[model samples]
Target: MPIVKNLVTQMSGQIQVESQLGKGTTFTVELPFQSAEQEEHPCGGTLDNPVSLEGKHILLAEDNAVNMEIATEFLTMNGMKVTQAWDGQEAVECFATSLPYTFDAILMDMQMPKLDGCTAARQIRALSRSDAATVPIIAVTANAFAEDMAATTAAGMDAHISKPIDFAALCCTLGRLIGKSSKN
Candidate 1:
């Protein structure tokens, strides 16, 4: 598909396709070789330690019980406090009622009953509180398409994280978005 092709091209790679009547098509992708150092140090130098989320408070807005529990447990294991919201409307309400700067970030599900993620995000952003505009609202959903990402941005979300969540990536993203560096 276009996504795979685009990824290959972005890596300064090439792709070829071959097909024959009554036979399955074949596709090949080739990219410039990378050394171990290049692979490890993607930025071409030593990488800083990933920021830690210890003691940070997070608002987790997810509808599914299993997902909420998993995400909550992971966050707690990483020393972050989690406040759960079952749907988008509840998420908006929770943010509205909370004290300013009480949350380090919000993980919002894109689909929910009562109100969708986009509407809730806009509502949160429209709040009159000081933290309304500043708080990071991250869309956490199954919609991983490029257009879906764009939709989250358009809806005033600060970030987008697709599910099933990548716990390490989630931590790093949260750290980047709202954490204070351990070096601080």
Candidate 2:
């Protein structure tokens, strides 16, 4: 049996692929990011339909510029508004100063200058203010190990995501927490 993979372009265009036994295929698509007719669908599943990222605000804490760009691009592509912090210290500041409970989620990078993800998460958890205390802090890092997950959990992170972030998994996690479907 053959498998089909759909590569969505910057615009609403998509490249479709079909692969079969003992055979190979290739395709390229060049398209601009253009506004298209909105399609509505039931939420909570995979991101298969266009969704409104209008009011959603995500705080992204990463030390690397390249990583920040990549993450910002991905999150923004899916209709998310993002605030980027160059390191964990800045992340902490952002969380501490911003209106409590204003952010939808915090994507914390494990390896960051100054405060680091675990420390930042702990500080956020330790907040005396109740609104800021329970905000979902999700670990986003390249470190994928049992110990790493355990450590993050101990630090009060609600979930952990291995870097080169998986869109589907992120969507699923957000859905479970925020009660919204990515396929909106």
Candidate 3:
């Protein structure tokens, strides 16, 4: 409930929750937006361009099998190598045990059974490895809120991507974070 409210507020929207005993709860969300009359970039210059992830290694931590598969497929399609971890604890362990710079980046899910994403990120950041402080840690989460973004940043994540993940945004973010540019 709080997460929903935070997400609404983060999007410059409002949410009202009404609850009655023995009944149910109703959530009202109001979002402000302007209508788009035409395509902003009809030629699709940047949209048509492919983002290269060649030779980049990504550590992906996701508990859901379906999500993990989909994310992995997307990354592989973009030419990136992916290593999967089912939970945050495993993710932390993987990062800890790996050589410095073994992974170019980490795509972390916020919620998990063992340790949560924030805790895992903190653990990774605290490690003595040279890449611990340098590797890009990105939060791939369903929690799309200002507070959520703040929390990820505080936990040493480099960026945040909301679920029903945007592949283009993911690519752009990865490219920017790793100092690579998408090909035109």
Report the number of the highest-lDDT candidate: 3
Per-residue lDDT for 1-184 in model 1, tens only? 6645755775679999999989989999899976654443332233344455789999998888877887898899989999999999999999999988899889999889999999999999999988888788889988999999999999988778777776656766777778432222
- Which runs in model 2 stand beyond 4 Å of their true positions? 1-54, 180-184
Candidate 3, 1-184: lDDT as tens digits: 5545654766689988899999999888999855453322222344334445788999999999888988999899878999999999999999999888789889999999899999999999999977888889999999999999999999999999998777767887887787631121
Cα TM-score per model: 0.71, 0.70, 0.72
Sort order, TM-score high to low: 3, 1, 2
Which candidate number would show the highest TM-score if scored against the true structure? 3
Expressed as tens digits, the lDDT of each residue in 76-173 for candidate 2 is 98888899988888988888888866788889999898988999999888877755656778999889999999999999998998866766677667
In angstroms, give how far residue 68 of model 1 lies from its true place. Answer: 0.6
Query: Each candidate's lDDT (Cα)?
Result: 0.82, 0.75, 0.85
Error of 2 at 149 (Å): 0.2
